[model samples]
Target: MPLSAGPHVVVLVEGRSDAAAVAVLLRAHGLDGEGRVKVVSMEGVTNVARDLRKSRDEHPDAMVLGLYDVAEERFVLGALRRAGVPLEAPVDLVDHGFFVCDSDLEDELIRAVGTAVVEDALDEMGHLERFRTFQYQPEWRHRSLTDQLHRFAGSGSGRKVALAERLAVRLDATTTPPPLAGLLGRIAQHLHP
Candidate 1:
């Protein structure tokens, strides 16, 4: 079914990588653009308020969920306020407030796809050594490999879909951080409910 024409849960981020990761998480859990969910990024937070104000205008009836690292939350929230979004409104705000550790989503990608695919993807991107170095950090040792990959994929929708397909092969109907089944369930709930 088609999503309604209203403001959806809009997740605004700082870059394509973070956008991709959040998208993957949303898709995996089954939230989408059929009027219930949407994802966007500002590239830079300087005028994010203006951008979200524009989104508010476009989808006035829906909620807006904003996500940016805590480092930039002040600026991002200021921008949104400048754009006329009310500060106390739940319909207009949500942020995880921090960048993923290990430098970027690539770390999570490496964790998810395994060393082989991670290395292959990096080699394909010509950043193999850089990624390898990052992967070896002590902090990364704490997170499960799959969570890392999901974090990378969840940064944006296109990558989310791509990663979801890959994860689908490895997961079953029940899983946290969402498996494909989780995504489908959300879609069904949103579309049918």
Candidate 2:
């Protein structure tokens, strides 16, 4: 599974949710991501170095982009630095085709669409009642609505991935969170530049 054999660029993400979100954004912006870009989920942020090495080894000339949580910026930066990308700051990472989510992809989406809209999305997806039940739990009851929503999404198996796909589809280019927008723009530049 050489990335170079299939696509012009690779977008490495922390997990499936990030992959799904990136794919949806690329498609929303009119790029044939499935055909032209390879989105790989390293499965965890800690695997950045291993994944980057593998992708580069397999596709020496293919552009590599990444989306990661801000909490994992150090790991991503260290990996990039080891790979010879001279990044001095988070913004510098963006210039090199890596974007960091503020807290994580879920947080970014919640902020982009707002709690009300996300609640509506949950309601539409038939998860609103489940979410409400989770919120009423003793430990969760005191947390902020946003925090509850974030936890609820990650609590259930595959819920984060499912919600990410739905949320990404509901977002347009204008409302896309900054990190996601930057990642897509970086990919577009690589594809068209």
Candidate 3:
């Protein structure tokens, strides 16, 4: 049942945080794709094109899915094209089993779960006051609290990944971020089909 030993789905994500977020959600949903679904972190969006190619080459029979930031859509789309997917536009991503985050996964979760909920989660993690300090920085002081939260979470994948797991655990069907939720559903279909 190892990922490399059977039929599986290969997920290409931008970073560990993206990987962490999706993995946590998948488990929470009881998808149990550990052996059949692999989440591959390319570590950066810039590597999408190359990573996509490599993944397909390595697992030609596996379904390849991806989650990418809006700012990095070009890279994902370019990668899809290079992979021989007939993508006509960004919306076409979902049809190909890829999803785009508005800005990034952090932003999508923050917006879906809310700034206050995230702050509460930070408080539970004993990092609320520290996040308060982060918010007071000159560069972030004037931004919206949600924007500050995104920046704070994006500061490190450690925090981002931890928060993603925490938030996803608290997320019910109504609160799950569209991309993450959609990705989970896709994973389910792939495994069950």
Candidate whose lDDT is highest: 2
Question: 1 or 2, which is superior by TM-score?
Answer: 2
lDDT of 3 by residue, 31-88 (tens): 7644677789999999998888888888888889999988888787787788777876
Q: Write the per-residue lDDT of candidate 2 for residues 1-193, one digit (tens) a residue.
A: 4434567788899999899888878777877645678889999999999999998988777888899998898898889889887775435677678888989999999988889988888898789999988989999999999999999988888888889988899887678999988887877777777
Order the numbered candidates by TM-score, best leading: 2, 3, 1
Better of 1 and 2 by lDDT: 2
Tens-digit lDDT string for candidate 1 (1-193)? 5555653455565666656556665665556545466667777666577767777788775445454444555676577567655677453233322222233334434444565664455465445565455456677656765544444444444654454334333333433222223334433454557
Q: Any idea how many clashes model 2 has? A: 0
Lowest lDDT sum, 10 consecutive residues, model 2, at: 1-10
What is candidate 2's local distance difference test score? Answer: 0.86
Considering TM-score, which of the candidate structures 2 and 3 is the better prediction for this target?
A: 2
Best by the TM-score measure: 2
Model 2 regions lying over 4 Å from their true place? 1-5, 87-91
RMSD of each: 7.7, 2.9, 2.6
